[model samples]
Target: MDVTTRIGVVMNGVTGRMGYRQHLLRSVLAIREQGGVPLSDGRRVLLEPVLVGRGATKLRELARRHDVEHWSTDLDTVLGDPRWQVYFDAQLTSVRHKAVVAAIEAGKHLYTEKPVAETARQVVELARLADAAGLRHGVVHDKLFLPGLLKLKRLVDAGFFGRVLSVRGEFGYWVFEGDGQSAQRPSWNYRKQDGGGVVVDMFCHWNYVLENLFGRVRAVTAKAVTHIPRRWDERGEPYEATADDAAYGIFELDGGIIAQVNSSWAVRVHRDELVEFQVDGTEGSAVAGLWGCRVQHRSMTPKPVWNPDVPTTERFRDQWAEVPDNAVFDNGFKAQWEQFIRSVAGDGEHPYDFYAGARGIRLAEAGLRSSAEGRRVELEEIAP
Candidate 1:
């Protein structure tokens, strides 16, 4: 029998939506259900997280729910303890940098949600700090771990799609307006001051997905709009929408593979989910949803005409066929968390290190600047 690696985790922001559902419940406790991650060295990774937050009662409740006896409101005290090897942050985007920097200064491995910082410079600094400290660091780029995206990556690597030409990403859903009679998300999500907005929140996903599956973006031109001028809050009080709800951007990848990403918090879709990606290559094309992937090829191109006046049945409507499922894994977030643990144990490479995460933040910063200036922003222009 092999000994288990004792990992003490400082889990900040465990009471939030993502913190509770994804990190605490699904990733940590759920991974425990599967006997945790088995390392190649015959050691199992055991997570011992100390839930940290300002509210003592909330922290206690969360710790009890997860069967973790360790809890703390003082981040300094937790960081001072050598037992805690990793400091994980799932707090609001704006506060991530300071907390992460403090952890790094304390010589602890670090993992946190995406957008390492609200700005590119902050991300660069964080990257520099991590590198200087020689600590293992990673950011949550969970989309790449999605079963659908992984399938797409495999197909792309296999040349199932000859020379890749273009990619299209569609992401959106109907966000409830905080009218007096409706449920609304936290107000911070909609206010720029609170690090809220669809562009900042989601563009990180698109940046990593594009960089991983397609290529690194060399440039970007974007347009942003605030579709709904006002929305209701949890208090049923209407607040003016100050952030952009929709963003359309064109990305020039390294190899000239052009891609477009459309992100919104205000759109209706009939598809299985609001997030989907379609890639076109020389030999074949593929579309992926949360559940599966569909592929189409030159050999399967539907016979059609270029006449718009013809009936709707005149184009390549049925050319695509679903790619069979081949993955045997848990949720994407959970998988990432498991991998992070392995990486921290020195068993594998840190999945999405600070540099990769900084790149995503840089891309988002570029897009926002481009949208505001109505011009294309070159990746090189933004320092990472």
Candidate 2:
């Protein structure tokens, strides 16, 4: 690698679990240690993250533990610094738009977690602002970078899917209430006032996943509910779950493919993976998760004669083939971070920009609207 060009990034909300583990520990720090992301031109962009968060102890502990030299509690001061060219946010969804807007006004390149804003308007507005300033901006769409999804994309690209039929995605795991065991997630995730809802959170993810893999989500018919009314908080106190813990949705995609996804924090996992998508096409079908993918071709499909009279024994589970990892796979979030930094360095084109993030927010909004109105809402066509 040529002399590495360090890109200083102000990382906020990294004290949180997802932010800390995925963005900081797995992505940024890993990139730094590995001598940065390689560009097509041979040069590399080394990420220098300045850990910023609300809690001083956590920040300090994280900094010391991770050997991060620069850390700050003041976001404004960090953003004002000329040394840092990128401002990254993993903060609460409620405050994300305001922070991103401030970062944009500061004339810095931007990167942040999903659902860039609470509303579609704000998401689009951020994309507009970033475009107007001619600054590089990206939001997390890590699912696309997952190894399983990558393999699935390869199948689609290879014409293995032929004409795609329908997609079914199941994403959920039980989150223990604070009563008997500590809740795995923060209490804010269960409170709507804190911008907590399954539709807003997971639909943003499903948006790009479906769009990129299957097709664009044209319309959505959804039902959302707060499955658990009350849950114990970190303080061992019971609080009303104002947010929807569960959401069941069916999306009408382009090319007449139907997509259905169920997201819930209250459900138990019974599938092979915690989150899985089964894509059934004309010629073949594939089930993909974060790490693994299984495929079954129409030619290899089991044909069992339907007989209600007697129980037939056929090994249906053994019919499909598992997609092997011929190559080492990087962390999903880390992979996206590398691509984003490469794009920032003018090495590659990353189309998953702020506009894509807005589309994600649009899908989320559409799901909420459909659930509320009990009608399928059409997605306003946006540029891919």
Report lDDT (CA) for all predictions. Answer: 0.84, 0.89
In model 2, what lDDT does residue 344 have?
A: 83
Q: Clashing pairs in model 1?
A: 178-232
What is the clash count of model 1?
Answer: 1
Q: Could you give candidate 1's per-residue lDDT for residues 1-384 as a string of tens digits?
A: 657877888989989989989998889878777777889888898888889988999998887776888998999999999999999999988888889989999999989898778887787788788878888888898888777888898898899989899998899887878674464467778888888888888888888899888888899999888898898887778888898889999999978899998998788886656688889988999988776888998898876657877667643545678887776846988888888899888899874787788788888888899999999999864332
Best by TM-score: 2
Consecutive 10-residue window with the lowest summed lDDT within model 1: 310-319
Which lDDT tens digits does candidate 2 get at residues 182-230?
A: 9988999999999998888999999999889878889999999998998
The segments of candidate 2 whose C-alpha lies over 4 angstroms from its true place after superposition are none
Report the poorest 10 consecutive residues by lDDT, candidate 2: 375-384
